[model samples]
Target: MNSLIRKMSMVITESLMSQRTICTNIRFPTFLQVSSPLLAEPMKKKKKMDPQIIKAREERKRKRIEKSIKKLEKNTKQLKPIEEIDWPISLQKQKLLRERTETISQPQQGQDILKAWRSYKYQQSLQETKMIDRISSSQLQALEQLRAISEDLYIKAIQMDDLLLPFTAAGPSSTPPIIGYDVLDGEYIDETPKWK
Candidate 1:
């Protein structure tokens, strides 16, 4: 009887442990099915973006930019050049700014030749007079003083017998000379030609 009780107790403990290991709430694969046999069904389709579609989109964008650029170029071509239009003459002016800032007769180092040339102009002007000649003694003195500013300019202009014409008799003189303004612009009246 004692051996029978020990065997029955071991069997009960083993059954209780096995029951503890089991998950009782799980309804594992109660209605599992892969291929149905009750009725046939239509296949579902998947959509894909084709290469032709993507390439056509890119080509369309390129063409749009090209068209816009051509339009811009055409508009740019319509602009006018600087030489095309004849602007108002009043706006254009030629200023006499060369060596005007310096005194014309204050000689420095290598300026003796310039001094000689000025002296010669003084002598020449003294020897002659013209119809349009309105220069005073002071004016002649001032022009004589020009070598101080531009020795080369004064020397070159009066080298040949050329700088004395306008100050000489209006027409032909025994010697022709380069002439400058006695009256600046339109001061010459009944006898003299107006300055250009």
Candidate 2:
């Protein structure tokens, strides 16, 4: 009897499932149907290569890596030499000749003169600083006055001058130029040494 009941239950469940499937097919037709088949393929087998060839490839790769490492080491060990910093062989040979035989002592007024010079420099620096402060204060006062008088003019005055972008000035020469002097062009030769 128990076996008969189990068989009946299984049949009923199967019938219900079939009914559900039929109802779903009739009532809710699939809106999104896949046209393309699934991309399913067996995994490819790895190709067997010769051991000697593999070893040779690995050896070549290792040699290439070592060559690059050797190149880096060579570059790291070497530094570019500056020509100006190196002492000339001729100057090195004349070291003893260039040495002074007698030692000169400072004069008694040397310290006083140095102190006077330092004081003079300090005074000059103070005067320059004061002058700069005065000029800046005056400029600020002028800007304030302009701002109070006119807003547009003040705004224009505060903006950077584009005309001064390519500023160039010629300083006064030591001697006045001749009234009719013909300037001659001189050839320029570069004496700078090139280093690796």
Candidate 3:
């Protein structure tokens, strides 16, 4: 009996749906209208250009290029050779030091004008002592030579695009490395990953 009642309800629902579809079509014919077919040729894009506008844009681009070229030429002219350039006082001091080193030599002998007996005695005693207290002529000459050699090395370094002057220091220990830090959980480390 339950199966018979279910079959009757399904048949009634189907009939009602068919009646609704038929009534909607007759009452609103526009809803059932079909769209027209597509054109064979594709539609043109709406990006038409005016000749005057195009000319103005091109003129602006040309002016920008001209300005950039002028800037490049100016920069080149400003970058004269070091010898030709006028150096500031501080720079002149460095150059003078280099030139002085090249020209350094032994000091000339001169007469001593000490009137005080104590001063005279002190000078005599100093002369008698082993040349440790005084800068001997030969030692001065050797130091001058070393300075000249260092200047030459500096010039060479500059020519090779290595402007940093050489220096020496104690080597880093293996136990606690100087380069990298030990990372701990929830703690900041000195190492930056972006540089690596």
Total backbone collisions for each predicted model: 12, 0, 0
| lDDT (tens digit, per residue) of candidate 2 on 1-196 | 9999999989976866555532436455433333556889999999999999999999999999999999988899688789999999999999999999977757857987999999999999999999999999999999999999999999999999978788788997698879898798788789999999
Best lDDT among the predictions, by candidate number? 2
User: What is the overall TM-score of model 3 with all chains considered together?
Assistant: 0.21
- Residue pairs whose backbone atoms clash in candidate 3: none
- What C-alpha lDDT does candidate 3 achieve relative to the native structure? 0.68
Which residue runs does candidate 3 get wrong by more than 4 Å? Answer: 1-44, 79-196
Q: Look at candidate 1 and tell me the lDDT of residue 111.
A: 89
> Each candidate: what lDDT?
0.69, 0.86, 0.68
Query: Would you estimate the TM-scores of all the predictions?
Result: 0.17, 0.31, 0.21
TM-score of 1: 0.17
Candidate 2 has its poorest 10 consecutive residues by lDDT at 26-35
lDDT, candidate 1, 121-165, per-residue tens: 988886676422655665566657886778887777567675556
Q: List candidate 1 segments past 4 Å from native.
A: 1-47, 79-196
Q: Output the number of the TM-score-best candidate.
A: 2
